[model samples]
Target: MGKKISFVSSKNRGITLDMLVVKDFFRVNDEKVEFKDVVANENAKNSLVKKGNISIRKEYCKNNTDIICVDGSIAGKLSKNAPEGKRVLIATPYDYQFKAINEYDKGAFKKKNTYKNFTHIIVGSPFEKELLKKCYNTPKSEIIDQVCIPYSWRLNQEEFKKKHYDKYCKHYPMLKGKKILAILLTGELDEDEENPYAEVNWNKIFDNLDEDWIILTNSGKLLENMTHIGYQHRNQFVYSNRTFDTREVLSFADCLVTNSGLYATYFAVRQKPIYCLKYTNCEFEKYMKRKFSNLYIKNVEDIDMTKFSEFTSENEKFCEYFSYDCGENPSAKISEIFE
Candidate 1:
């Protein structure tokens, strides 16, 4: 009966400690939180209650009407379960990886949380609601596409660049200057039954970029012309080297590089010149077209340094669906939500 809420586990507690414990939602509700209706792996369920973090079993979630979801499917499921007065909210960041419709891929059921439909949906813009509509297909009356993300509080993207942008610049042997090209790259799931990655070697692409680049990755050995940075270290085009908090790396980036698709969330942070393409022999590119801001670069010659900035600045399409806002971001907005 308290401000108790239910959450769907990302991967049976596969979510890193940093993702949940360090996120804005968790931080905001520090003492005013309780997870009674929890949905997660047995290990996660046990761990939370054993640690006294949650109050009951995750299955308790099925019967409870009070719930909100960080993902779409869960929101739909909860909406189907709630009583007439009870409701659900969608609090996750949105993008191409998330569909406008409920898509249960091979592993989707495990993460599904929504029941019928949410009473009200929260989003960053009408654009986000439009994307959600692509999935939920509900009338506009049920959705609330509000600017709720708080990117300002996270860290400065510019600071991130200053801290490590030049660390190995000379050593990496790439051209450098304020007019730099930083590309953050990601890909959609591999669907090719015969060949994955389409034999398109990434090293081949990075080798040809006549500009300084940092390939951020959680793993894959320290890369050259690329920053093999981790998730927390990732945000805008740059951030304060002294701190992980994000500022304006995106909007200010001269050139941005990424292999990420809409499934990845870094793009939601700030706007910068961005370069991305679909993985060969996959439906990823088809989905990327939904955003319409990405460039499909097939060869080294197709890579245009000048256009990187152009893409980031022009990509206002994604601005709509992102909601999982962070930063010193929206302290006022957040207070109002709880108010």
Candidate 2:
């Protein structure tokens, strides 16, 4: 009999989606291999169900499974409990956030033996592999660098436009002739409740925009404030709640504006024009600025409205240095380990 693998993921959509991509690859190519999905939440379960008819479980079970493909952090916690003989595989895109770095600096992993159970660790890039080596003093032979990108990355601009443009235009008639400007906010509100974007000069930014653009925002709060009478371009903005898929909006967008995160990387890989906002001045923000030096703007007022056309032309150059290899077949590379 072939190896039986169980793919596990946390509740985070980014992690779950990447796990699904790897799972789909195995389903199509390795008919002899048996596998099951173990997701943390209902949302992840729904995503798996939407993909195809597959066996799923809420918790990880190692009884029949020869290999356990799970998230990085979760693998650490499972190490002590995992049976001695089973191979634990970690295929994750998590870019080692500030908290994890701090914990590593404090020698927390040494005390806990966090990654002791992992048989193979496959990360999205060399950057992530280096982080794992630095943090856990992991052996070079155990770690593999394979960039796991979103399945949507396979869709080119022409294909995406043909599939989604007409449907979106029908729903929002104003999107017909004008250029679509997608604004991606973190959607996190502060506890103070005064104003989340108090640092940004929103009024001056909106006033400088050309009238021919249709602004699409994911934040309802930002949308409400922008649509108020005080803003000059109130009529030009449209809001989509969490229920609406951001990828659909990104598919047809002419350009994107955001403070760095997973969505920003997605837009960058699509080779689209993106203007990055740097308000938080966090570590990740600094990393983004380093990657997109010409595209980073400290303040909203720093954006030059007239230069958007020029910016769009330089997207390929800007994204050439992007860390992840979205063009490579990560699933194929990962499957080779079993072969």
Candidate 3:
């Protein structure tokens, strides 16, 4: 059916954002999706795509003219001579970054492609749709909101302790008997080059905190010294060597705080209460936090560890805002219900 929808991502490492979206599309086991049959990069098992249960191959994209543009990168991506069957259905977040799709929609940065290509744009929010219409100069009809997001899961905190805690016990047995607080820091070096994380003393932060914490990150530069600080789950202090299950990581986090992942942002907005710090690697996120939602922070200091009600309240509002019913229907978030 639908010629086994072929999903593609721009990168071949870690948990590419697009793969997560595909997972969300399926939402359940009974409702499986025939994702694009791309092979996983040679060394991508630890990557996020693997967590999604999808396989990714190299850039063997035969330009399946019927390619789906999930993210907001311009490039009508569909060629003119390509068979009319080649359609690009993009399942994207509501926000467009630094440059608006408008920049590309208007013809090679010279003219708009709304009239040129048969591109179907699926946005997560209505506000984003409005923005697309304004920027891409496309008709409102072309911009449809499908709240249906990518792979989603309920926080099975119990499952996390059962599966991961023991592994840590072997590395740092001391960590086995303590109440822990987890602070996850998503390294932004890949996106923000100037800020090489060489100065970030993960060792110091953990040492200074009164409570025990297992810091999780993808960057390993500072992990070399986790042992010096009496970190019980020293090895539990994982750097996303390759993007292991993010939700697993998220569930593992008793207390949550992350830089800014589209998934994390979605979690934050839904009242998931992930201490969203100010200024994200992406401009659109900053726009959402500072300008759009109150859950956003100017800095880590802004968060009142004592009163977390603020985050929960904001999440409730986020749930009410769009309802995302536009994305699919009553069951758009059904997986969430079952979980």
Q: Over the stretch 259-311, how does candidate 3's per-residue lDDT look in tens digits?
A: 44444534432334455554335554454454446656554434344443234
lDDT of each: 0.40, 0.57, 0.44
Model 2, 301: alpha-carbon shift in Å? 4.4
Model 1 vs. true fold: TM: 0.55
* Candidate with best lDDT: 2
Model 1 gets an lDDT of 0.40
Superposed model 1: Cα runs more than 4 Å off? 10-30, 35-58, 73-88, 91-116, 137-142, 148-255, 263-265, 280-284, 290-294, 310-313, 316-339
10 residues in a row with least lDDT, candidate 2: 50-59
Error of 1 at 16 (Å): 8.1
Worst 10 residues of 3 by lDDT: 53-62
Q: TM per model?
A: 0.55, 0.69, 0.55
CA RMSD of all predictions = 8.7, 6.7, 8.6
Distance from true location, Cα of 264 in model 1, Å: 6.0
